[model samples]
Target: MAPQGVAIIGGGIFVKEEHLPAVLACPQLSLKAIWSRSIKSAQETAKLIPGDASTSVDLYSSDSGEGKSFDDVLKRPDITGLIMALPITEQPAYIEKALAAGKHVLAEKPIAKDVETAKQLIAKAQKIAAETKATLSIAENFRFVQGYSYGAEQVKQLGKVTGFVVRISWSMQTDNKYLNTAWRAKPEYQGGMLLDAGVHFTSALRKLLGPENAVDSVIAQTSLIQSYLPPVDSINAILKTKSNVVGSFIFSVGTTLSAFDFLIACENGSVQAEGSRVVTTRGAGQNATKEEKTFEKSNGVKEEVSAWAESMASGTPNPQQAPEMALADLELLEGMLTSGDKDGARQKLELQHHV
Candidate 1:
């Protein structure tokens, strides 16, 4: 099949750095257009596109006085899909518009600002998708990372899961590019940085635990350590999966501490992942054997984009990038923040979807 003609709909930091590179690198996709809220930003981002794509790609801006606009691009016959990474609160409307225009979409997560908004958007999008025969895939690139995928398979082979622990700590400095974004710095949304960054860890952990062992409940305590990070930036939670496997999740983006690890212990053995490396140990004591695998340059952004292009080409959505999965990730993060707000009151997850 000919490459699917698609457009990059946002001109923000992530769109310029990650999404643009990944979309340009995907052979199954053709860069037909680039749109930003401003024409100047759109043109600047287009410069990053090399060779033929730089000339072939059209530019549209929402603020333009001419006919060149996002809606105009959507009306074009050549563009059949959209890959977008907009501010969390500004995404749902764009998603609805794309689906209504009968274009497939690959949108960045946490799906929406919260579960209720996500549910409403998803329900409407699903109906439109069914009628238009188009697809909507929420991008949670952590689901495609090498270490997490390897660890997940190891979990299946390691027998009954006993428990797990996830530790993530890093300071989002004032100079941090992501933190510099206005939406992130002020964050009108709930859980602030906790909601924005927490979904990534949640997706990875859920990927390792698999569907049958999805997180069912959480009791957490959250706090804002740095004054600039807004509502909250740290969370410590105890989680229980549907299979009775218990685990602890601790994430803090406002601290000076810089450590990250996800460990799953099973009856026969255990799997541990730190960044791009995954280690598995089997057997006991002197007989215990350990093997470690390291992945380089495997952030999964390109892989996830390529998967979305393939799914769009084949007219089927990849379950790994399903909206429901994104919803589950958001639910877990929201549950943690909700429980934290209630002084560690337990919160149950009812909208979680498994794959």
Candidate 2:
């Protein structure tokens, strides 16, 4: 089969570092063009596409002449797909336009700035997809991470889930590259850094718990400890998943403390995932058996893009990257913030995904 030509629609940090490498690594995809809001940024990204690819890849931007604008990229017949990583609030319109132009889209996560917008985009995309057969796949790298999948499978085999705990903390300092983005610095969106970063954890949590034990509700207390990260930067919540299983979720990106792990205890054993490692313990104290496994450290962008390309080729959407799945992750994070604002009033998730 011939490789599908695709364009990248964002020329930011992640587009240069993660998406570029991922696209280059996928043999099924041909790097065709690059687009950004500025010509300089688009040219900067084009420079990273190595040798032969560099010579063939076109650069487009908002400032471009008529034939080299973003709309031109969408009008391209050879470019049948797009890998977009734009700012959260600005992505939906671009996504809709691309799909309407009959191009499959592998869009960045936290589907939208909030749930209502996400739903609207999904509805519009579905209508466009039905007409053009173009697809929308949301990118959530945690779903493709090997450790989380292994941990999730381990949880399923360890019998009924009893309880779980997710504790993660990291400092997003003044000099942090990701935090330096103008949109991220003074996020105009809801939940600020918490919404931007928490969605990944929410996706991981859902993956580890499996569909049968999907999170159903959350009651959380949120606060802004960092003067820089506005609205809120921390969340302490209790999650209730299917089958009445309960868990505690604590996430803070504004603290000096550094830690990260997700542990699920079951009737027969417990599985924990930390970074690229998975550890499991089974049986009673003295007689217990324990094992640990490590996976190659990766951002999971390669596997995710590979999967997205495969889905495009097969004409079947990858369930993991479905807009519904991304919506679920955003819904969970938004639920936490909504609960936080109401002083820990329980927020029930209506769109929780199963598996």
Candidate 3:
């Protein structure tokens, strides 16, 4: 099928840092245009899109101020969906506009800084989608990454999966440019590193395992590691899914190593994927053996963009009922944090729209 014509609606670190590279690299999706308030960003986005005058994508300004902006791009005949990677707070208005314009959408995580906004956006997106029949996807790219994909696939292959475990710990150097302490450290934009990273883990777990999962009423602790940015440093939690499965989450911005891996233990077998490959151990006791499932590094951004294209053309979603990933993950983060509060209470998460 032909690739969907996509327009990205943000500039700055996320667009330049992650989205730009991915969009440039993706084969199934074409960077038709970009909307950043800055002309410099507009030029940068235009340069990255793959085309000449015949194929050039119109770059738009995301600023929506006194200057030219994406508001004009949304009215164009060629654009279909808007890929949003804007700050957590600045998302809802754009999402609503995109949906109203009969355009599809794919947004970054923590759809909104808070759940109420998430609900509003999701409900609005759904309403527009039902009426307009367009696609609305979340840019939850971590799920497309090989390591997480393999780990989740193993859980499916192994019957009667009982539990899931994941550890996403990375000690980002203070000077890590990607993680600007100024923007990310600020709670409103970053929502802490977990909101940024941990959401990926929770989204992965729910999709790979089951959203019916919750931290057992019995055991689980949510521990905050640092305060670099309000609620952006780190957190750890042990959870149990309704399937009677137990999963542990160890995520920290203060990790000594750049460790981000998920291990799922099942009744028949267990799988572990680190850095690149997903390995499985079969049988029980010392007799058990280990085998790994390896796949080429996924062109995740490309695949994700392509998926959005196909969904728009096909009018069907792959992981049906999977709520907007970024929004749901943020809700899960909220629940985890609230449960992790000093009272030591059980948190309820309902994000598993489809298991």
Candidate 4:
């Protein structure tokens, strides 16, 4: 099959650093165009697409105030898919437009700013896909990351999971280019840095625990230690899954300490992951056996982009990071925030059934 022609919308730091490289690496996808709010940025991003004249990437912008608009890109017969990297608040409308135009869409994570909006967008997109036979997916790179994949497999080896704990902390200095983005600094979305990056950690936890167990309820506390990050930047939650398994998570972007740790304790054994290393222990104290595995660091952008392209070509949705799964991730985060607002009172998580 010929490579499916796709265009990337939103020319930001992530687009330049991750998506561009992934698009170029995926043999199943052909880059056709780049769009940004600014045409100059679009042109600059286009230069990163390593290809000959036959593969020349077109540039368009919403701020151009002149030439082809976003709708024009959607109307292109040659472009059958779109990869959206816009702000969380700006994504849903574009997703609707793209799917309505009968174009497959791979959007960035967290699905939407909140659950209600996510449900509405998902409902509308599903209806369009049913009618037009288009594919819609969320780009959750953590699911494809080498370390997380390894950790998940090790978790399964530990037998029936009883409980787990996740801790991720890091300082976001003012010098960070990505954090300095206008939308991020003064995000219209809830939870500020927590909502933006916390979804990935929640997705990772969900992957480790498996789909059979849904987050049932949560009790949490939130803090905004970072003056620059409005709303909140720190979150600590205690969660209970549908299967009765309990878990705790602590995520902070305001801390000076840097750490990443996830541990799952099961009936027969336990699995622990610290950074890129995963350690599995089986048996009791004296008989305990330990095995360690280390995975190469990868952002999984290429893997996700490849999966999207293959799905578009075969007319099947890649179930790994589907929109529904992303919505579930959002529910977990939103539930925590809501529970925190209620002074750590347990809040039940509401999920929408996806066909």
Which stretch of 10 consecutive residues in model 3 shows the poorest summed lDDT?
Answer: 211-220
| Candidate 3 lDDT tens digits, 1-355 | 6666778887766676667676666666666777876667777766654456325756566453543576787777677778887766777788888878888888776667777778887888788878877666777766677676667667777777777667777776667775673557565643466676667677766666644443333233454455554554666666766676766777777667577677778888887876368788888899998997777776366567656666677778756324555656676667766766644476776654544
Give model 2 RMSD, 1 decimal: 0.9
What is the TM-score of candidate 1?
Answer: 0.97
What lDDT does the true structure give each of the candidates? 0.90, 0.92, 0.67, 0.85
Arranged by TM-score, best first: 2, 1, 4, 3
- Name the best candidate (by TM-score): 2
Candidate 2 vs candidate 4: which has greater lDDT? 2
Model 4: how far residue 352 lies from native, Å: 9.0
lDDT by residue for model 4 over 72-92, one digit each (tens)? 898889998999999999899
Model 2 / residue 265 / CA error / Å: 0.5
Candidate 2, 197: how far from true, in Å? 1.6
TM-score of each: 0.97, 0.98, 0.86, 0.95
As for candidate 2, its clashing pairs are 211-355
Give the per-residue lDDT digits (tens) of candidate 2, residues 1-355: 9999999999999999999999999999999999999999999998888787698999999998889988999888899899999999999999999999999999998899999999999999999989998999999999999999999989999999999999999999989998899999989899998888889999998899888888899999999999898989999999998679999999999998898999999999899898599999987588889999999998689999999999988998999998999999999989989999999999999888635
